[model samples]
Target: MKKIITLFAVVVGLFAFSSCTTTDDNFQEDFDTYPYAFEIKNVDLGRVADNEYNLRSTFQFEINDNLRDDETVLIYRLTSTINSNTPVWQLIPRTIYFNNGDLVDYFFDFSKVDFFITARANFNLLNRREYIDDQTFRIVLIPSDLAATMDTNNYLEVMNTLKLSENQVKKVKL
Candidate 1:
């Protein structure tokens, strides 16, 4: 009985000790920091045949399937650039008001497989070539956790926070 008890105690001790040792390599951090960005240049808005007041454009770009519910999509319009390197990006759902009291809004929506850019105005956009043609936009995808901590309105800040450089951004053909 004494020998049996000793063997049982040794087995239990061995099991407990083995279970206490955890390998870091076996564990993965829940935080996902990988971010990506893409640009659409000179994309002409097409009039929705059914709705004259709406000008829309669609692009097919695959987003990470796992991040479909866990990510934030931010869209910006390339308003200007200094020295041909530093781009000034304006965040949308932006509203542009003309002197004549016509207002046009730029906004976007996205799914896991594609995204749509839409221009909606109080008046028909067919006559306003400037608002419908040759528009440039940038789409940035980041984790929801990072998006909450960053200043999304400031394009430069967001870029810096994401550790993204101009060369890193790829231009997508539309």
Candidate 2:
């Protein structure tokens, strides 16, 4: 009986000691700075078809070297406004990983036509200015009720914008 009690106490002590040892390798600190810089790199508006449209865009953001060590999370709100003078704006909110390079997309009914694409990126609870991209062409329904044709120029334009912003952010190191 004495031996068993001693062994149980030794096991409990060992368990407590092991639990106190923590590794910080995977720990990411929170961001503590403000005025983070971000840009919408690319905006791709898919062709409208049968009164429906598909849109996707990519945003690239760079944290100042001072804040780079901190793990930053990015939240975005996308809105579609007509004529740039509307007081009521349609809102779409999405959360994205800052370190992960992913493109965000949305599908909407094209019948409710719009003229501008406004994307706002929120970083670490700080609200950044809304970056507005104007749509040069109007979405028209195909007589055949087919999807709108994909234009090479539009796709290339969006790709170029994303590439440029990503390149700029990649240059930062801390």
Candidate 3:
């Protein structure tokens, strides 16, 4: 009788261990979806301060909720349009030197929740509405690891690397 009880206990233990070892078919691998992009069209930059000559605008970037310190924020300007209405995009922190020898710079800064696009120049932009109005910009958020592998200056390359279509990019207005 004691031998039979020992055999029953071993059988139960084996069954329990076998059940634990079985793999679940429903298990799935985790995919990291980090990069995202957006476009703001025909927006005007507001004056940064009462007396300051710098022009600026604020944009809400909700995706930066978990933004790491090393992450990248890329800004681009719609420099012009081509024959088929294709946009010619130029990366920002761009300097435009005027025929008058004055230069204006386009750049931006970002925080966890938002970002500010600013235009600064050696000359006053108060009378230069053309430089501050109807501006279009594209903002891209990327992980530092991914940013390190690509040619950031090439807009089409960046777009392709991120597998982004024009329809995938959300259009925003200010």
Candidate 4:
């Protein structure tokens, strides 16, 4: 009975000791200093119709960070660039300018927010039957110090981008 009790105690001690050790390689418990980073997400601009003159799609981009006092202003620019300069394409300019690039005050109590943005891409695909399969564009959102400084020609240095989120528009026709 004495020998059996000693073996049981040794086994229990070994098990307890082994379980106490933990590896933190997979996870890091750290806080972010600049916890105000924002991002654009869930952008669902569906397929465009061939004869559809005005392709209006409503979308909202997600901002990652919670509300910070200093990061109150945001200037957004949404535009598309046409690769080919064909005459029919020229009927519609390659650069489709969306915003005037003015800094608008973002009002939110919390740090995180889903900043709602509206984009009216005047996708005039009916102009030419020979349509370009895929047209590309960019959506730029930058922090601005002054509201007046944000314009078509003006933008701040720090910008958060949609990595694989380059807007791909199709020029379709019936």
TM-score of each: 0.71, 0.20, 0.71, 0.26
For 1-174, candidate 2 gives per-residue lDDT tens digits of 999999999999999766644323332222222222233323443434322233443222222333332222222222443565531222233233356443233222212122233232323111221222322222211112111222322422322322222223222111
Task: Give per-residue lDDT, candidate 3, residue 2.
Answer: 100
- Per-candidate RMSD vs. true structure? 10.0, 20.4, 10.7, 14.6
Tens-place lDDT digits, model 4, residues 1-115: 9999999999999987656442233322121222222323223323334322222222232335422343443423233324443111111122344365322111112224432
Error of 3 at 16 (Å): 30
lDDT of 3 by residue, 96-122 (tens): 988989888887777776777778887
TM-score of 1: 0.71
User: Each prediction's Cα lDDT score?
Assistant: 0.72, 0.30, 0.72, 0.31
What is residue 40's positional error in candidate 1, in angstroms?
Answer: 0.8
Model 3 lDDT, residue 6, Cα: 100
Look at candidate 4 and tell me the lDDT of residue 16.
Answer: 76
The lDDT-based order of candidates, best leading, equals 3, 1, 4, 2
* Cα TM-score of candidate 3: 0.71
Residue 13 in candidate 3, Cα distance off native in Å: 30
In angstroms, give how far residue 159 of model 4 lies from its true place. 5.4
